[model samples]
Target: MPNSTTPSSSQALEAVLARVDAGLDASLERLYALLRIRSISTDPAYAPECQRAADWLVGELSGLGFAAQARPTPGHPVVVAHGPDQAGPHVLFYAHYDVQPVDPLELWHSDPFEPQLRTDANGRQIIVARGASDDKGQMLTFIEACRAFKAATGGLPLKISLMLEGEEESGGVNLPPFMQANRDELAQADIALVCDTDMWDRQTPSITTMLRGLVADEIEITAAARDLHSGMFGNAARNPNQVLAEIIASLRAPDGSVTLPGFYDDVAELSPELKAQWQGLGFDEKQFLADAGLSLPAGEQGRSVLEMLWSRPTCEINGMIGGYTGEGFKTVIPAKASAKISFRLVSGMDPDKIRAAFRKHVEALVPSDCSVRFIPHGGSPAITVPADGDYLRKALSGLSAEWGKPAVITGSGGSIPVAGDFKRILGLDTLLIGFAHVDDQIHSPNEKYDLDSFHRGIRSWVHVLASLAE
Candidate 1:
């Protein structure tokens, strides 16, 4: 076990943190250089920019004493940089250089690519740009940490294998294949470090230990052979819309918990310690509900807001469509209704099992006159990091020392496909220490990153490397 009495280490990092603060202007300059690259992976036009972004990372990593290169992949290139792959516990640090597009350009107070250092309403300074927070701002936290370590100890203490992908925001299709082919090169590490998540509120630093997995399902409920006029067959004809509603209603109980059969069979309950930690959040129900313009809890009854959003499993309807009413009301009973639903599963809850349960629920809800067809979109199970792992504890201590605040262990409601890819392709666990804030608005307009988070995040990594090296 690593000692928590690293006052000297803390003092050393404090000095580096001050340096990071004084040199924050230069860091912003670097970020501006990256943000200027329009590396949107989803669109074909930004392909060259994507490669350019990878090249930029190669330069930065190489400057830090790593033999880094921009490796060509099937689509965009991956920047693989290494310092030492030898003895001490290895870590695969993951991030993405590619960003989302800036459409509806008229909405911006300033150009999206040209980063501006602005302050939010609460007087917190933020870096405003398209990719400022989504990743560029976030990933630099780790890179800056490495820089601080280099400045302090002359090198990064642990064996570091950095893998920054260009296609993470898009579906990560190329990443799994690459990991499959280079398992030895990538998965040699005991654990992976991912910086794609967010901080809990603004004051609380969190480590994402659990992420609910998902299974995308598209279901079409077919009733009559043709669209029926409500006046012609108001009482006799079966309505697919009604059938679809019945199917959705049957998915969960009145208490707001998912009712799919066997959905809870494999789910593991949150432990006492985790429960206490979540409770300590001192969550305000009104503020949380108000943030969404809501007044009621939508998940399982009697569970804390943290539990419902992070720990509990759920089945939600992403979309629904059937009939047409373009202008005024059209009094026609739709012939078919379709709904897309997904389940947020916990560890051990197989997507296959949840899929089967969902289908069975729909089948039971289907009327004798109608047939239902299902379209499988995608499926995956939940991820739970080993709470007792050695490196896990080190990371926790690292955050505590850097921020002078106890690190909060929490679960994510959203999912990252690469974490699952690491397990499926290379049998490795991921340590997610993300620095993005909830209000960063990553994929949307007006994206920003807190200046404090950007600067402190780097120092956090410095302490983390020291802990891991020990």
Candidate 2:
């Protein structure tokens, strides 16, 4: 039997932690250097910054004993790198280097790019900048972890393949095609490790187990051949805006549950195990609401805040536009009004069926004088990572050993398209192990990643790799 001793390992970990502590300054320096690059993928002006970020990653990967390269996609370049060993189960590590734009820059405590290390009023020293927490901070957690392994062990504890993309924030336009084209090279991994999710709380680590599915579409309603002044047409013409509002309003009831025909037909309710797990989390809804600047649960009347966010499905009108206003509003009954609507579906929900149901609902609602058309976007089904899977047990063991506490297997409220894509195309299960926190403020101004998360994240990855080998 394998020995159950940890004294030697504990010594090694302490020694590694010491090296990590010593290297914190240099790590922050590297992070600041990376943050300095304006890798805003959405803005065409920052294309060079994107390339520079990829180049920087390539250099780091090469320096860390990997054959790394910056390969161009239709959009910004993707940073690819791999370990020398091919004997172990291949694991693909993922993180996005590109960050959102730091607009309305006045809200920041300091310059967005010109990062500074400062202690907040609470005495927590944080790295402040635009990309500090969003992704550059999050991505560096994995990279810096690899750095520590190399520093202490002369090599990584396991073989790693990195697929750091640039277009995650902007809907991952090129990632699918990029992965598809490089299927032979990318899909060889036994599993994928996505480190772009949030922790349960600041102090508690989490393993994301489920991601809600998404189906988006725009509905255009036409009531007249052309716009007509409300004064001239008064009581004679149908106002497309009103019609649109009624149709949109009809999709939900007072309780906030989606009222679309058959919208809940395929929704899977939370299992007893899941319910018990979430209940055991001890998450205070009041505190969570306070953070979000709200007091009431606005989703479903009978569900917990965690349920509303994680397990329950929702339908929301992303945007709506009708009529016109330059300086003052024009009292015109517009010929057409559109509402961009989307659905967050649970497992067992079929996107096609939901689409059909929505179309039928709209068709039934619109009168003969009014016409409606639907534009379909790509839809994906929800994914549930088996909590009882062998990999999860091993992964939790690894995380527990590192964090000195049980890792929370949580559910992600948002959609991660790649996870579903991997399930469909590669058949590889994703282990959502990330070190991000709620305050990281991804996609918001003044995004920042925590320093401790960065240092500990690397060692955590090392432990996970070790666990996987067993």
Candidate 3:
């Protein structure tokens, strides 16, 4: 068993914390250099930029005395770095180097690649760039923490393995195969740390213990062979648009329950204890909705917004197109209509089963004259780490000390596929801790990470590493 008591001297820990504070300017400069890479993995034109980012990380980690290399996958490369060999528990830290593409570039205040530090309306200093808050800024936090530890103690507190992927914002297509191929090297760690999630709020730290899985599908319905004028085909023709709309509309009942048969068979209910803990967090549903220009919560009825988002499964249509949707009106009944849909899965739900059930439901809804086609995008299972493990307790204590408030054990509605892969392929459990805020606007224009989050996040990792080293 791993040591449960905190290790390292108080003076040594304080020295590391002070070093982190003193190195903030250098850390920010390094982050700025990385942010300028334009490592957008989804676009083929930026492939070289992704490689550059991976190479940069390798150099940086090597400079810190890590045995680092940029290993190539079928897609973008992954950077693997090992810290000083130590005797205690080993930890594998994971973060991504790739960022979402910056579209609608007109909305950005500055070039997404040329990172800028600006003060928001609240006088909070923010680093603005495409990947500032999503993963770059968060990744740097752990690296900076390791740097501070090396500077203060002459080595890392514990054995550390760093895995930085370059294909997270885009689907992580190659990570699974890479993990399977290198399972022995990666799975030797006692625990894993993932730094790609959000804090509960600006002032409150959080550890995400649950992540919803995902299943994405694209559906196309075909009727007439070609587009037809609505006036000419009036009541005689079947409109694929109308049929697709009806199918989408039928997905949810009046109380917001999904209409797919056997959809709820595998969904597990939240334990009363867990529900009580969430209730104690003072989550303001109204404020959460109002921030997004909404009033009432829109999920399953009789459930709180937090429960609906974190625990329950959901089906949503991400995009739909059937008829003429240009600036001007064209009264035409299109030959085909299509919709992109995704399902947020909870634990115990099978992605394959959900896909089959959904296809059956859509087939039943399709008219005899129209045919439906289903194209699967991707699927991943939900991941839940034990909330009461020694490593988790250590993280909570360390984070609580750093933030001066207890860290909330929270659940993420979003999916982090690698976390599940770590469990399945590596036999490791991950602790999801990050410093990004809800208002960070990740994957959106004007994405930003608070200067405070960057600085304190480093210090927080220092604490966590020291505590885990015990």
lDDT of 1 by residue, 1-470 (tens): 43232224556656666666666677778888998999999998889899999999999999988889988888999899887544567888999988887877888889999888888899989889999988988888888777766665566666788999999878778887888888888877888999888877676678898988889999999999999899999989998988888778877788887877677888778889889878888879888899989988878888888788788888889999999858888999999999999888777888888898888888888989899999998877678888898988999998887777898888888778888788777788888897888788878888898888888787778778777877
Candidate 1, superposed: residue stretches over 4 Å from native: 1-22
TM-score of each: 0.94, 0.92, 0.94
Candidate 3 residue-wise lDDT, 1-470, digit = tens: 43322235787789999999998999999999999999999999999999999999999999999999999999999999997778788999999999999998999999999999999999999999999998999999999999998887788888999999999888898999999999989989999999998889888999999999999999999999999999999789999989999999999999999989999998878888889999999999999899899998897999999998898999999999988999989999999999999999988888999999999999999999999999999999888888779999999999998999999999989899999899889999889999999889988899999999999999999999998887
Tens digits of lDDT, candidate 2, 1-470? 21121113656556555666778779888998999998988999999999999999999989989899998998999888987773556788888888888877778767788887777677776777877777787778778867876787666655688999988877788988888888888888888888888777766788898899988989999988999999999789999899999999899899988888678877778889889999999989999899879998787898999998888888988999888846877888899999999988877788888888888898898989899989887788888888788878878887887888888889978889988877776777898888877777767666666776777776676677656655
Ranking by TM-score: 1, 3, 2
Q: Please report, as a residue range, the 10-residue window in candidate 2 with the lowest summed lDDT.
A: 1-10
Clashing pairs in 2: 133-447, 133-448, 133-449, 145-458
Q: Model 1, residue 248: displacement in angstroms?
A: 1.0
RMSD of each: 2.7, 2.8, 2.4
For lDDT, the strongest prediction is: 3
Q: Which regions in candidate 3 have their CA more than 4 angstroms from the true location?
A: 1-7, 228-233, 327-331
* Span of ten consecutive residues with least summed lDDT in model 1: 1-10
Q: Say which prediction, candidate 1 or candidate 3, comes out ahead on lDDT.
A: 3
